[model samples]
Target: MREIDVFIDTEEIADFFYQELIKRGFIPAEDEIRELADITFEYLLKKDIIAEEWDE
Candidate 1:
């Protein structure tokens, strides 16, 4: 069997989350959303669910 890899853009995810927050009437700073997105990514990394690219 071949293993498939997936990649996720944290910045794009942050932007989408920010927009959703605004639509739901929650006001959050852009940096705050970015930080949250980073944290989420880190958690996934720690759980071995995602891998970070260091050769970019």
Candidate 2:
């Protein structure tokens, strides 16, 4: 288990986060983008895929 402080209002997070992750063909809708990001973060958390402090 690990802990850290994060700052961001997901609602106001620069919009279309997942879409911007790659300059792909289709742009995902705002809601779909948020959902994709949420699901990805949850999966990473469960898999312990987070980066180590030294990574930064």
Q: What lDDT would each prediction earn against the true structure?
A: 0.89, 0.58
In the range 1-56, model 2's lDDT, one tens digit per residue, is 66775443445443556546556666567677777667666675578665323335
Instruction: Return the top candidate by lDDT.
Output: 1
Candidate 2, residue 23: the lDDT equals 66
Stretches > 4 Å off in candidate 1: none
Clashing pairs in 1: none
lDDT of candidate 1 over 1-56, digit per residue (tens): 56678888899889989999999999999899999899988999999888787865
Per-residue lDDT of 44 in model 1? 93
